[model samples]
Target: MAVTSVIASEASLFLTPQSIIFDEKSRSQAVHVVNRGNRTGVFAIRWIDHTMTEEGRLFTWKEPDKSPWSLQPYVRYSPRRVTLRPGESQLVRIALKKPYDQVPIGEYFSHLNVVMLNKNVEESIRQQEEGSEEAEAGVFRVVARTGISIPVLWRHTRDQPAAEVEISQWNSSQQTLSLQVKRLGQVSTRGFLHVIYQQNGKEKRLLDPHPLVIYPNIDGRKVNLSLANRALAGGKLYVYYSADKEHWDKPLGFASIQL
Candidate 1:
């Protein structure tokens, strides 16, 4: 598995509105990528397709086979290469191209990947004099580059999917919780989830608000979390979800399971 390093908005830079949606009449939208680092930041922007699987994992592709959910061919964004000084921002405009009549009837998804280049290392290398001790040591200095990705989707139809969840596996010995979240209906289900634990008249809350998205290509996601407490013989976990747009943080329904 690959490890990811997350950067906060003020220190590292970020994209405003991590996700985007579109109305039927809108043709284009723009996203801003800001640089909060001390040095000039270089970014290489590109569009990629992601397919959610039945097991709830996302698979990305540069060019995928034609399907109801592919978003690569129709998406366009610029300026693909950006050079910004510290605390500067740039606009990346995304537009959808057509043969609209040929687009499939379900939701299509794509991602705008804003990848950061190792500018500090490049700067260091440029300043090095020939055959110097400092230059020889500079070759071993590792550069850790980081960036952000945003999901953009266009739904061609009006069918909104229903989402459901169940505890598929719970390992009390390991203090792990596993849930199988399923999505129904024609469109994807994007929501927020809150997890709580209860035992012996006491309650404990876990997770500091999370985003939930179940796409059309994936039927369900199997999520695993660890429970730390060991004293209770009987414990139950309660979970709730709500749609993202107008119903953010409000639970439409909740479910519980005994451990």
Candidate 2:
């Protein structure tokens, strides 16, 4: 019997167009993945259905009963596996194919996961036979695999979705504000959350706009944002959630609280 082990190296991967959306009219999209690290990386691309917790944590949904919002059955991606050298890039094309007549109409969600596998099988076998110096030095070389994920959403129609965000609670001692974002329609909403502090007719941004999303499966999510002490003294805080710059005039929702 023979045993083999390979030293694992981390790869710095960058993905463009972080979030993808597929509509009734457009059913295909491509994502660009780049390996920024010096070592060569092998990635396995796949789809994973996820559920977001109230506190903004994502967990894989693998129960016997599938979620109504799961996009697993309808989505497909090309180049399930790939090997890239440093500074190399690959485009993963994703397509959606749903039996619209059978499935319910709404938004579906899934995550595209890029996972790094063990590197250089031949080199590991050679090292094992040679009893490498690192092995003589008693230094353990463990294979550590890592991955990156991005959301891929699909909708049956092009109709606009809406959601409402309100300041649910404030922790003065901790300088944190809890926001309750409630989904209003059957579709999901993705946008930016802007927090503004207005005092005596003057307004200033408390924090850089935060990326916000409300998926269809869940009714609402709670997001906690930290506020600077100076901004909380004697002003009114206003929060606005808008899908994008083009839809600024028609914001999804807004709420305010006086400090």
Candidate 3:
């Protein structure tokens, strides 16, 4: 006889009103989790607050609970355990009650996590005795797990005018190398650009410069580095940028050239 199994559908969770805009007033919003799967699934919902501190450390907060999930805080249900039938869904109401009026202007981010308990594992555990062979099977059992990422942003009024940076041309005359950066949306007052080049399994910094404040929406500045001295004839070049010099975001641009 063929065995029947339960499978969770590919689902997603996101904020409604997409992005939140608050100017010193209380706000309320709803976060929805949709069940796109063919089978009903149970979800444990919670909120995670990731904040950047003044000392450059990251502080995390789990909503409705003082201790964080990572720290093993008491687990309480925000919407309780939710059961979604096939093609069914649920909504979680989140209110920015107090501190919304006092929050500083910037981006505040949070994500929703939907989890499915492994019924198969639970059944196997129940079938096995303390010293039975079936109990040993528990060690080899595999469980299915999936997660979705949601980003939330809260912005206040800007104190300074925006600045933009653009990279018109990035190339290595002697070797094959190119790097480019274009500011998207409103630019900040200051930023840094960095490039990392690797050749023959060795890595080296190509161009590290501190450019002046760039005006908004203007043409990008150009930086060209010739690899004649470094013998960077052909290899991989990774380029990235950031507001602070020490911390760089993932390399948005990559190029592989052969000399």
**TM-score of each candidate?**
0.71, 0.80, 0.44
Candidates in descending lDDT order: 2, 1, 3
What C-alpha lDDT do the candidate models reach, one value each?
0.71, 0.79, 0.46
Per residue, candidate 3 scores C-alpha lDDT tens digits across 161-236 of 2323333444555553434444344322235656667778987777664432222323233444454566555676
Worst 10 residues of 3 by lDDT: 67-76
Q: Clashing pairs in model 1?
A: none
Candidate 1 global lDDT: 0.71
Query: What is the per-residue lDDT of model 2 for residues 2-101, given as tens digits with 9 covering 90 to 100?
Result: 8989634545677888888887778789998888876677888887787776666777778514777888888778998888777789999998775665
lDDT of 2 at 187: 82
Query: Candidate 3: misplaced stretches above 4 Å?
Result: 1-26, 49-77, 118-140, 158-163, 172-259
27-64 per-residue lDDT for model 1 (tens digits): 79999988776666678887767777765677776456
Which wins on lDDT, candidate 2 or candidate 3? 2
What TM-score does candidate 2 get on C-alpha atoms?
Answer: 0.80
Looking at candidate 1, the ten consecutive residues that score lowest on lDDT are 244-253
Task: Note each model's CA RMSD in angstroms.
Answer: 6.4, 6.6, 12.1
